[model samples]
Target: MSEPVDPAPRGGGVALCLPLDDEQRLDASARRHGVRVVARCSGASELAARIPALRPDAVVAAAQPQYLDAALVAACDEHGAKLVVVAITRDEQRLAAELGVIDTLAEPFEWDAQLEPAPGGPAPAAAADEPVAATPARGEVIAVWGPAGAPGRTSIAVALAAELAGRGGVVGLADADTHAAAIAPSLGLLDEAPGFAAACRLAGHDALTRDEFERVAEWVPLSRGGMSVLTGIGSASRWPELTAERVTATITAARAWVSTLVLDTAASLEHDEEISSDLHAPRRNAAALAAVRAADRVILVGAADAIGLTRLVRARLELLEHVPPERVIVVVNKVRASAIGVNPEAQVRQSLARFAGIDDPVLIPWDPRGFDAALLAGRPLGEAVPRSAARAALGALVDERILESAATRPGRRGFFTRERRLA
Candidate 1:
């Protein structure tokens, strides 16, 4: 196990923000360790406002049930504060990690025994000198695509956003599939305001701004408990103005306002030749490609069947030219154990490994019953069927892998980097 970090005197004092018992324990521990414990907040909101004023060297949040939310985590990021979360649940530890909580302590931890900084060291400087090089701020775009069949690209995109949002960060979900946009109906999103399409149009003319874009977003309520959604085009005819550059800028602006920006792209990456004949054909594939290039992580979804797998393999080869394999997360969807052949997971994995050389593809089992229920109830998998095996599998992927990856990747500038730059 890694050694416990010593309390660093990064100029600012330590602030203990936790519940009553944990706060008392931490206060005693800090006093014994020769580190000053400043203030303690009972609630996350209170702590959020107090953080900037107190400017604590480090904030120790006693990871109680109530304190585990995105708002608190986002507040920490906003203030560029170091956070240590003490978790009561293993699941909470996973969730905390997803939210970028640096140091986590399991429950029943002896505060006094572990609170001190190591003998040789103070903590690393609270803030870096060079403004810690931010990740490619909102410039990376990802367009999720699959063939016409039940390739489950939309499902993967929705789940991916839900996971990112659950990490206590802002996420934007854009439906860019003009031909057969299903994000709204799939998530039971009722607002048909064409906000994303409008944003795309405004961006085309360079009129998109952080404020304006937020005003345009429809704020589709989430079913799985956290984050909001932004729906897309009402019809394919509206695709004329949603060009690649405009879409890219719009998404960039959205990412500026949110931590994760998820685009539900068109199934076909090929240019619409019929529309190409027109002056305003709106090169769809180019727009999709631009989004793919901008995304920090790209999830490519494909059906488990033979034809769907074939299309995915082909798409994988094409995507490799643009994105690194590491950035591309492949999901084999609609796998059914009772289906025609061998176990769906093994078969799909074997096929991808054999042909596409893509190993360890994230397999989403076929859950038509659960999916239909969610669709009918207008909820995400977590809400409509929280206990469903499909939901459990999705949670494992989202809560475990995607969110964890987002947290550990240093240099990520947060969603509002562009706004910060402009300010």
Candidate 2:
């Protein structure tokens, strides 16, 4: 590999979130390095609010309030800015880099020499003979998505999450639907409680730790097992709170601690067309999009009826644009003999094979009575009616597919590398 020529002499902009002493040193260095200090924040809280408006090219801060949290890093990622954390000691420097900062520097260092790499450039390589940082184990993120028309997305997602919770290990269920969210009410959770929305805010400020996330995530009481849930907004108009960056941070942090994460997302994938010309305009489907993009597997749910099947096929086609086909699991919900004649499951499979080339799709039988009872009680289908046809079918899906996939998944390890304690 060869070094590329440096670009034009335009001064790069930076945002500072550092102590008084460190902040002053960074300022002096910025002047010496021909870089502009666009914004100065006393801490992470102020930094999170200012970074977006100033949109600096880089950010430098203390590692504690700096790189450890996903929110600040995600904000930097969205603004296309670089991050460099100041570490007072060698151990702190290693920890900072492990926490996913763009780069690390010891105090009393030369700023011009350290800022040599261009924005978006790869991190500086480790020494030839030195050991490299270990890659952390990443948990599985399963996103349940579908088009409009109540295709039973939430039911399948909740049922799947409940089942997985019983299998062992930690599981996180997130309601990421920006439009008309119902997870909280569906699960009998308190509508007034702060959940995913609050977690996103904390994540935005880089203040959400693993323990803090658990507090924001509501714990659901499953008859057979239990799982942690991050409920959706109380109202539809609050969609702006579930921005792509915040959603990504929440999910990323959840993955760090849990073995599996099930997400219930919105029906649409369309962005704001009226403001399409402006890249910063609010996207209504951002939560759904972020969930799908971050997922290891996407469970595509659709109704088994004619109109529902047509929408399912189209939705699958659209979903293919975002995730790989192999990673998608098709689930036909509310199957009934009257809708598609005798052997409804077989018919649905044939249709999918013909139109989308998807074989072995999971078909859930319609069970209005059981489903209605579960909905009224605000409990999972399995707990409300364990032997219900739909519930049994969903259980089979968990046994044959979801659980097996998560169990056999390779590289189950801690997300953060082992770091020496600070003296």
RMSD of each: 9.6, 17.2
Q: In lDDT terms, how accurate is model 2?
A: 0.71
Error of 1 at 142 (Å): 4.5
Top model number, TM-score: 1
Question: Per-residue lDDT tens digits of candidate 2, residues 129-205?
Answer: 33222222666799999989999999889888877655443568888888877888888898676588898899888
Kindly state the number of residue pairs that clash in model 1: 13
lDDT, each prediction? 0.62, 0.71
> Would you list the clashing residue pairs of candidate 2?
none
Summed backbone clashes in each candidate are 13, 0
Per-residue lDDT tens digits for candidate 1, residues 81-167, read 556566544345445544545234433434443343333544344462223222224333345666667687787777666655544
Off by over 4 Å in 1: 1-38, 41-57, 60-142, 222-225, 272-281, 406-423
Q: Name the Cα RMSD for model 2.
A: 17.2
